[model samples]
Target: MVAPLKVGIAGLGTVGAEVVRLIEAQQSILSARCGRGIKVVAVTARNKSKKRGIDLRGIDWMKDPLAVATHPEVDCFVELMGGAGDPALSSISAALAAGKSVVTANKALVAKHGVKLATLAEKHGGALNYEAAVAGAVPVIKTIREGLSGTSINRVYGILNGTCNYILTRMEQEGLSFAECLKDAQRLGYAEAEPSFDVDGYDTAQKLAILASLAFGTKVNESAVSVEGISTIAAEDLRAAADLGYRIKLLGVAMRTKTGIEQRVHPTMVPLTSSIAQVMGVTNAVTIDGAGIAPITLVGPGAGGAATASAVLADVADVARNVRALPFAQPVAKLKTTTKAPMERHEGGYYIRLMARDLAGTAARIATRLAEQKISLESIVQKHPNGGLEPIDGTKKSSPVPVILITYATSEDAMRRALQAVQKDKVISGKPQVIRIEKN
Candidate 1:
């Protein structure tokens, strides 16, 4: 039998501890499948004496994680110390520099510096695998990097943040406001105390950047993605979406456009019948649209110790079997420098909600503005908060009525200009709420 693959793990957090437990539990089967044993020879974490619920007996402990990565006995560096900077980046660099393979669950690290790391790994004849970085326990990365290697992928998108999904699902299901849902999420441990990263859509943006590169064969560009969070979503918006036969989901989408590749993370209105809309709660779903194949959607738990560990272990098993592939499914040099599609040029259907003055010709004036920009409306609805148009403030001519309009496919630039014109006409109150509509 071949010698076992020795792994050195850095950061024994929830996911890391679970990785160790999983390896120990599945040792016999993993070894038989890989034709060689996979063993945790060394481990490093913030606290040496911390209880991880896994027996760490007989394993070497390293005070410095960098030492584990550069250790002579360690063949693979499993980096769970997630950060875009510092010890994580430097240690991974050192590992690849020393010709050691690396497997990481660090999304920030991968999304920020994937190209450079992939270059380093290839130059040093080492492998770099990170299946847990994007959608946890979902094989979207592997499917795009390997399964769809021969296909021309058009669009790749999904609900990438579990915290945001959980909050949004709670809001829609319970008719709660965004603040209430977010509070419940934090209390239930679905969201962190400072949930800006996940709630503000930056987490999904980072993951989308990595996925976009793999799908479009472009260099990773995290800064190019246009991001919007679910924090601004209100119960009224959720009710409007339901009435329109749609569900509001924070989606990270990347696709080839006429001008360039478009990557964005925003609250999107998807048909309730769509598979992605069916994915609720903390679950996530990724849809791949490619040539010669129907759209494929993969849905599963996007995060958790057990689910994330499953992905990490899969990467480890690949390394154990000597599975080799380019870090981004293609040579670093061969990856194209794609143009960042401008948001103004984006063409899509939109759901526009506004507080319009309830008076004669108000709707007509709004329609005139859209017509001037050639923005065709599919439907227009005017409804009062109460059952009738009676003014709540005891005024007959100036009651603010809710106006909802769904427009046909139009350029974002045109939509913006039309909305601006409508605002100038003084027919709407406050900033209009606009959400893009996705057909799938």
Candidate 2:
């Protein structure tokens, strides 16, 4: 019989502790699947005395993450301690250099240093599996890496961040402001005390960089993505989107363009009928559009200890089965470098909400500016302050009117120029709210 696969886990936090519990609870199942038992031989955490509610009786407690990573009896090094640098990076590098397989859930680390780490794993002939890094338990990494290996991927986009999704969902359904929903998200433990990372779109950008690399055979470049947060998304915008037969979502989109690959994260207006629009709350979903096959969407819980630990264990099972795949789905040397596609040149439909000053010529001036830029409007709606439609030629009033305009496919440059001219003309009361329209 094959001997058991020895594992050493660094960081006994929620996810790390859950991984241990899972391995013990599912030993027979894991053994039956892998043809070998998976055993946790060592572990290390900051405060070992702190009760984690897990029985660590027979397992060895190492002094630090580095020690756990390079433990003599360990065959797989699992890094659950999150950070883009330091002990996590050093430990994973040491494990890979020692020809031991490694598994991790650190998206920041993978996004920033994935190519280099993949190079190390490739040269040392050890597997570098990080299925938990991208979409929690969604298995998107494996689907792009292995399942669609033969198909040509044209686009990969999704609702990658749970906090932003929850906020947007609540704002759409209940007409809550972004701030109110974000506050509730923190109280419910969905967002961090300092929530800028998740709220500002950096978290989704990091995850998108990794997905773009896997789907397009490019080097992981987080800076290539143009990120826009959900902080500026108002309840009015969500209401306008719903009226336009669309739902507002914080989406991470990566697609092949004529110039190159365009990756971006922003509050997008997806049609209410789209698969991604149906994904609400803290759940996650990813849609992959390949050349010939229909769009495949995978949906599941994107966060939490149980969901994340399930993905971490999937990587460990691959290691136990001695299955080694290139970390980014291609050789490090073969991965091409990618630059940030210019957002100004991006082409898409737009949803523009202008709080027009209650002046007689405001609407005429706005239309003239858009016409000058060759922007064709799909539709337009002007609403009074009391949520009633204002007559197109009604008498002017003192309060600013909400003018919502949906435009046909146009370049971002044209939209910006037109809006700028309208702003200079002082036809709008405040800055306009713009959300890009993403087609299914």
**Alpha-carbon local distance difference test for all models:** 0.91, 0.94
Model 2 C-alpha RMSD vs. true structure (Å) is 1.2
- Write the residue-wise lDDT of candidate 2 on 218-241 in tens digits: 999999999999999999888778
Query: Which candidate leads in TM-score?
Result: 2
Q: What tens-digit string does per-residue lDDT give for candidate 1 at 1-440?
A: 69999999999999999999999999999988999999899999999988878999999999888999998999999999899998999999999999999999999999889999999999998889998998999999899999899999999999999999988888988989898988999999999999999999999999999999999999998998998898888888888888889999999999989888999999999999999999999998999999889999999989999999999999999999999889999999999886557889999999998988877778888889999999999888765555222223323445787878999999999999999999989878999999999997
Name the weakest run of 10 consecutive residues (lDDT summed) in model 2: 386-395
For each of the candidates, give the backbone clash count. Answer: 0, 0
* Candidate 1 runs further than 4 Å off: 384-398
- Full-model lDDT, candidate 2: 0.94
Name the top lDDT candidate: 2
